[model samples]
Every structure is written in structure tokens, then in C-alpha cells.
Target: MITLLRSRRSIRKFTGQKISKDIQDLLIEAMLRSQSSRNIRPWEFIIVDDKKKLEHLSKAKQHGSGLIKGAALAVVVIADTNKSDVWVEDASIASIQLQLMADSLGLGSCWVQIRNRMATDELSSDQFVKQALEVPDNYSVESVISIGYPAESPKPHSKENLQYDKVKYGSFSKPFYQD
Candidate 1:
């Protein structure tokens, strides 16, 4: 499972290929299996396949550039604000699950932030996305995920290149594990 998680990378480029319905259903099931706070499961998914809509979304949403033209499908994961304070956490888990499932199924995926502070302000990175998608007032558009076959393999980040010295134990400056 860790290998699968580690192997999963954000795929911005995709082949212009369509995914099967059965695979889509399986991905949905993976989302459903994600754990939520107190079982609230305060997440809603909107799958977009219409070419026009996808194209419009690419211009509207943050990090949606490659999604519109490359991905076979785009999913909007919304969190019900009225549910609980942990709604965002729940939605995020589901989003990761969906992405992991896509990777396992030999598909590529990338997450586009939609409900962050940057995406909602006056100088929003994706103000047009909210209006274009017609997101409801009651729900927060947490993210947009693009899924499709990869056009080119993404280079993996090297673990050795990461700064592990900054990591600490229960207290600051205390090493958790010595190199």
C-alpha cells in the first residue's frame, strides 16, 4: 500500500483517451470507502465529461490548464459546510482515495485546488470556476481532479533530495530518527 501511495504522482499531461464506465464506477467506490470524521461523509462528487464544460473549467479553475484538454474526466469534490468542522478533512481523504484508485487502475490524475482562500478572493486564482460550475452557496468546492491516461511518465521526486533534518520529534529540534 505504501508503494502504491509513493508511486502516485500528479499527472498534468494526459492522452486524449476515454476511460471505461466500469473503471469510473470502481473509482467512485474507492471514494465511498474513504474514512470520514464520525462517519459524516460530508462530500459530494460532480463528474464532468462534456467537452465544452471541461474546456471552460480549464480556464476558470486553478491548476486546470492541462485538465480541460488532456483528461478524459474532471471531478469536482465538494464539501458540505453545514456538516461539521471536519468536513474539509473528510473531503480531502476521499479525494486522495480517488486519486490512488485512479493510479492503481493505470490512469493518471492531478488535483486542482478550488475552495482555498486563493481561489475565492476578489483576486481569486479561479473565480471564474465557481461561477462557471454553478457551485451552490451551501457547499464549498474543495477541489477539481483530472483523470486520464498519461501522455508521458512523470519523473519521481528523490527521497534523498528531501530535507529530513527539519523533521522533529514530540519537541522541536529533537531528532525523531537519526540518519
Candidate 2:
């Protein structure tokens, strides 16, 4: 688990190769297994592989979302707002689960944040995506995870570069690690 964590990196560039159906099934399994508060299981997912739709969704945000156009698969993470008050957190967990599974299966993935962001000066990112995907009312978009074989490989983050200061022991002042 630690090795996988140490090696996983957000991959934005992907090859032209397409992901196989077997691999895609595994990713779905990973997401469905995600633990949620009170087991409400509020999260749901939409697998987008249509080229035209992927290109359209690439513009769902003003920035940080163009990678979807190149991904072999893009999973839109959404949740039923009426099912749980913590739907955002629930959907977020499923998103990462999908990404991590992709990483483990020798694929690369990038998380595209959608909630509270903008598609244009006048449109909210969530609304834009919901309209494009035909998501039902009362459901909220949380993220879109783009997955494919990596066209570019990024080095794993080194331990020394980790922000140890960001972690505190019990309180804000004391350091979690002793030098």
C-alpha cells in the first residue's frame, strides 16, 4: 500500500491507446467498494468514452479540465444530495478510489474538480456538466477523473519534498515528526 502511495502521481498526458473493458470494470468495482458515512452510498458515476462528449466536457471548467479530451475514459463522480448531506465527501471518496484503481492497473489518471467552479463567466461547472451528461435533479457533480495509459511519466514525489510542516501533533504548533 505504501509503495503504491509513494508511486501514484496525477497523470494528465495520455497516449492514444484505449482502455480495455476488463480494466474499466475493475475501476467500477473499486468505486462501488468505497465506504461512506452511514453507508448511505450516495455516490454514483457516469463513464464517458464518447469522443464528442469528452471534448465537450473538457470545457466544463475554465482551466484544469482540458485533459479529459485525451483520456481514454472519464468518470464523472456525482452524488444524490437528497440521500446524504455529506454527498460531496462521499463522491470525493469514489473519485479517488477510481483514480487509485486506475493507477494500480497500470493506467494513469487525473482528477478534474467540478463543484463550485465555473465553466464560463456565466455558468457554474456543475450545472454545465450536469446538462451535458443529463444527470437527474438533486444530484451534484463532484469531480471527473480522466484515465488512460500515460503518454508522459512523472517521477514519484520524494519523501524530503513532503510538507511535514503541514502536519501537526495534536495541535497546530508541535511538529508531527522529530528531526
Candidate 3:
């Protein structure tokens, strides 16, 4: 897992190759296995592969979501607000799990945040996405994960680039970087 974590990077550019059904099934399983507080499991997954819908979702946000249109698959992560107070955290876990699973499967993925963002000055990204996908009012869109065969290969983050100063011991003043 550490090796996977070390090599994983967000991939925005993808080739035209479509993901296989078996691989997609594996990715869905990874999302389903995500852990949630009290196991409320309030999150839901939307697997979108249609080119037209992918193009539509690419505009969910103003600038950061354009990569979706090029992806072979995009998974929308959403949660039922009434199911848990920590639905955001739960949904976030599933989102990352999906990305990690994609990486393990030799696929590339990028996360597009939607919550608390805008599609335009007049529209909330959540609202725009929901309207496009026809999601229920009870659910909230947290993110859209774009996945596909990578067209551009990015080098893994080096250990030296990690901000070790952010780590601390028992006290915030005690830097754990020394350890």
C-alpha cells in the first residue's frame, strides 16, 4: 500500500481507450468497501461513461472540471445529508478509495470537487450537477472522479517534496520531522 501511495498522482489527461467492464466493477467494489462512521454508508455512486454526459459534467465547475470530458469514465460521489452528520467525510473517503483503486488497476484518475463551488455566477455546481444527473434533493454531490488510461505520465512525488514540517509530536511546537 505504501508503494502504491508513493507512486500515485492525480492524472488529468487520458487516452481514448475505454475502461473494461471488469475493471470498472473492481473500482465500484473499492468504493463500496469504503469505511464510514457508524457504518451509516450514506454515500452513493454514479458510474457515467456516456460521452455526452461526460461532456456535460465537464462543466460542473467553472475551471477545474474540464478533464471529465476526456475521461473514459467518471464517477460522481454523492451522499444523503439525512443519513449522517459526517456524510461529507464519508463521501470523501469513498472518493479517495475510488482513486486509489483506479491507480492499483493501472488506470489514472483525477478528483473534481463540486460541493461549495460554483458552475457559474448564478448556479451552484451541486445544483447544476444534480439537475444534469437528476439526483434527488436529499442527496448532495461531493465530487466527480475522472478515470481512464493515462495519456500523460506524471512522475511520482519525491520524498524531499513532502512538507515534513507539518508533522508534530505530542505538541504542535515539537516538530516530528526530527524523528
Candidate 4:
């Protein structure tokens, strides 16, 4: 698990290959098992594989969403705000779990933030995606994750690249002790 976490990378380029149904199921399972406040599990997902819809979603945000057009599949993460007060946090955790599961299965994924964002057409990202996908009014769009076979690989982040300066031991002036 640690190795998988260390090596996982956000991949924007895809080979355009289709993901198997088994892999999709695994991703969904991972999302469902993610931690949620009060165990309400208010998250909802929309799995989009349509090419035309993918193209339209690629324009959902002015930036950070071009990858959706080339992905084999895209999972739209939403949360039922009425069911959970901390819906966004819960949905975000689920999204990360889905991404990690994709990495473990040798697939690549990238998260495209949709909440409080805008599309190139000047519409709010959430509103545009809701209209395009016909999402229910009760749920709010949190993010869209693009998944596919990777066309390129990114080097994993290493301990050498970590910012030690930001880490505090007990108080602001104290440095972390390694023993």
C-alpha cells in the first residue's frame, strides 16, 4: 500500500484504451469504502464513457479539464448536501480513493475540480456540468476524475523532494527530532 501511494501520479495523457468493467467496479468499491463523516455516505457518482459527453465535459472548466476529452472514462463525483453537512469533504475523500485504486490497477487518473469554478463559456463549472449531464438538483458537483491507460509516466515524488521546513515538532520554534 505504501509503495502504491508513493508511486501514484496524476496522469493527464491517455492511450485512449477502454477500461474493463472489473476495473471500473473496483474503483467504485474503493470510493464506497472511503471514510465519511457520520457514515452518511452521501456521495453519488456518474460514470461517463460517452465520447461526445467527454468532449463536452472537457470544457466544463476553463482549465484543469482538457484531460477528460481523452480519458477512457470519467467519474463525476457529487454530494447530497442535504444528507451531510460536510458533503464536500466526504466526496473529496471518495475521489482520492478512486484515484488511488486506479493507480493500483495500472490505470492513470487526474482530478478536475468543479466546485466554485468557471468554464470558458462563462458559466459556473458545476452549473455547466449539471446541465450537460442532467445531474439532479439535490446533489452538487465536487470533481471529475479522468481515467485511462497512461500515454506517459511521471516520476514519483521522493523523500528528497519533501519540504522539511514546513514541518513543525510541537511549537512554531521547535524542529522535528529524528531518532
Per-residue lDDT tens digits for candidate 1, residues 64-119, read 45465567999878877898798889999999999999999999998887665353
lDDT of 2 at 40: 98
On the 0 to 100 scale, the lDDT of residue 117 in model 3 is 99
Best by TM-score, which number? 3
Q: Which ten residues in a row have the lowest lDDT in candidate 3?
A: 170-179
Q: With candidate 4 superimposed using the best TM-score fit, by how many Å does residue 131's alpha carbon deviate from the native? A: 0.5
Worst 10 residues of 4 by lDDT: 170-179
lDDT for each residue of candidate 3 in 15-43, tens digit (9 for 90 to 100): 99999999999999999999999999999
TM-score of each: 0.87, 0.96, 0.98, 0.94
Return the TM-score for candidate 1, rounded to 2 decimals. 0.87
Off by over 4 Å in 2: none
**Which scores better on TM-score, 1 or 2?**
2
User: Model 4 over residues 3-119: C-alpha lDDT tens digits?
Assistant: 998898899999978999988899989999999998999999999999999999999987789999999999999998899999999999999999998999999999999999998
Clashes of each: 0, 0, 0, 0
- In candidate 4, which residue pairs clash? none
Q: What does the lDDT read for residue 169 in candidate 3?
A: 89
What TM-score, to 2 decimals, does candidate 4 have?
Answer: 0.94
